[model samples]
Target: MAEAARGLGWHPFPGPAAVNSVRYQNRAACAYHGFCDRGGCHLDAKNSTAVSTIPRAQETGRLQVVTEAHVRRVEVDGEGRATGVSYLKGGEEYFQPADVVLLASYTYENVRLMLLSKSPAYPDGLSNNGGQVGRHYMTHATGAGVLALFPHRLNRWYGLPAQGVAIDDWAADNFDHSDLDFIGGGNLWVYSDRRPIAAARMPTFGRAPRWGSAWKAFVADNADRWTNCYIQKSTLPYEDNYLDLHPTVTDPLGDPVCRITADFKDNERRIATFVQDRMVEWFRAAGAVEIIRQGLGTMGPSTHAYGGTRMGDDPETNVVDRWGFSHEAPNLGILGASVMGTSGSHNPTLTAQALGWRTAAHLVENWSSIAG
Candidate 1:
């Protein structure tokens, strides 16, 4: 597949992954269990914070992990500065005070928490006096997909999602876009991720019935003969695509849930269409007998959600400053993709972690000024 991509003038290489390839830091290496895609790694080989950073922080005796706590709002003082947070635990409400507050509860929840924490000093919401808390929102354009069928088995029963070849030549301004209708591109990935249940549910390509002997026969023969390519395109935030409190729906706690008003614009659709064509060509070059292309669907909730508390230099257009601190509430910091202003073609995890470390370092270096 890498050779095929290189033949098309695209840069292809092994996709970067966070899973441990060998034993490190007393953690076991990847066992190739193949269930890492949807299930937890029993060997603790995946580099999740729960198994990595949290354990290290706990050893310092300064970090506390409170399980089953539902944070409701951020408490503020008369001067519109964050004081702490109020949460519900064991059917009792409690307030935890702090000198500095950091909100890192993912994108949607971060926006929702800020919106729900309205105070007398800031009547709209926390850090929302300028109404920019949820202005710019985006999710990766990841719906467009291409499935290919090969004549022989791929033997892909044992591998992880990251064990694949990726072509980034079409990703995010890497190639010429002067004559193109869109500004961003997509990253094409073909990985070894096959589960028995999911493989049995493969599309028959109009070769068999929906269910019965013919379908069972088709599944038995073609379950290991097909594969899909993942195409993640760059998405942009727009004025109309924002998040807000749902007027009608509420959670079990009676608090309003987040309401998303978003959709893929023309630029995203154009990129998906263009990239899928390239993907089909690549699959054909790799000896695919039949290929199925999916359409550019409407944008929905995504794991790669970004930008509800956008970071920027201007307070009027952004919620946080360049350092990820709130422009209105100086001591309040955000530590997730919610502060990201743009969604690139790649996953936001590494960038988010890097930004988080940067924020933490800045806070430690300027603790006196920020915590005050």
Candidate 2:
């Protein structure tokens, strides 16, 4: 891994051998079974929030977590200030009041809650006077390059998703794209995974059949020969790509479900093409016996969703101010990717956490003024 990082100029952005979360932390370390991507960790080796942060907070005794609380909306006063939140717990509705309110839900959930919490001061929703609560939504575009099949055994049967190499030479504005049709680029991810399911699903190359006895035999013989090059492209928010409550779709509580009305533009498609072309070149140079070309598909909801309640200095164009506090509702603080102005070609988890901590700190430092 170090050799690959040095060779490809990839700055070793190494973390815990396991995926950073409370989900995979059982048995001391990650088992490297590739199930990290599909399901919750059964071995308790995962570091998901369930095992780490929540327990630590409970230990403090000052924090009382109301489990299974499905928040419906943030309660607002007549003057548009957030008073607290109303949630459903065990089939009963309850209002939890606070001196101040910090909304740290998912991007869609944050937008949905604000839009639902309407009042005279914020008929469109709480802190939505700027009409920016559900606007500027963005997500990264993902596309896979051709399946590269090698003749030798890769011996890559076990590894976490983070255990891989990344080439950022083409991502962001690292390279000059003044002459290209696209405005952004994608990170080329080269990872090793030999899960049986992944091998069986590898795209057939050349004239190889997709099904039948021949296909089964082919998979068995070359299961270890195939690998994929992934692209996490930089996708920007546009006027039309946004989120709203679905008119017809409602949750069990009759609240409107989050309706994602988003799609990738030509810029993303062009970036996929440009990035995949380079991926093909790299694979060919690495002596791939066959390369099965794949197209960049349409974009959709992902874990990396961002920018529904964006932050900026201007109240007209943003929902929150520079400190993650709402411009309309002074006491409301928003955390997570909802306030992110831009989407880079990477995961927003760490960035979101950092912003959440910053917002909390800011609120703590100026609690008296903000709460008033």
Give per-residue CA lDDT, model 1, range 115-215, as digits (tens).
99999978988999999988889988657899999999989998787778998888999989988999899999998768888888899977889899999
Model 2, global lDDT: 0.81
* Cα RMSD for candidates in order: 1.2, 2.7
Q: After superposition, how far is residue 372 of candidate 1 from its true place, in Å?
A: 1.1
lDDT of 2 by residue, 1-372 (tens): 335445555444443243533433234456678677667767667655577567777888978888899988898888888889988999899999988999988898999999989889898888888788889999886565567888887788887766676677788898888789888787777776557877788777864699999888888888888888667888888988898889998988888888988877888888888888877766766678888778676776666899999999999999999899999999999998999998988778778878888898898899899999
Q: Each model's TM-score?
A: 0.97, 0.92
Off by over 4 Å in 1: none
Worst 10 residues of 2 by lDDT: 16-25
Estimate every model's Cα lDDT from 0 to 1.
0.91, 0.81
CA shift of 239, model 2, Å: 1.2
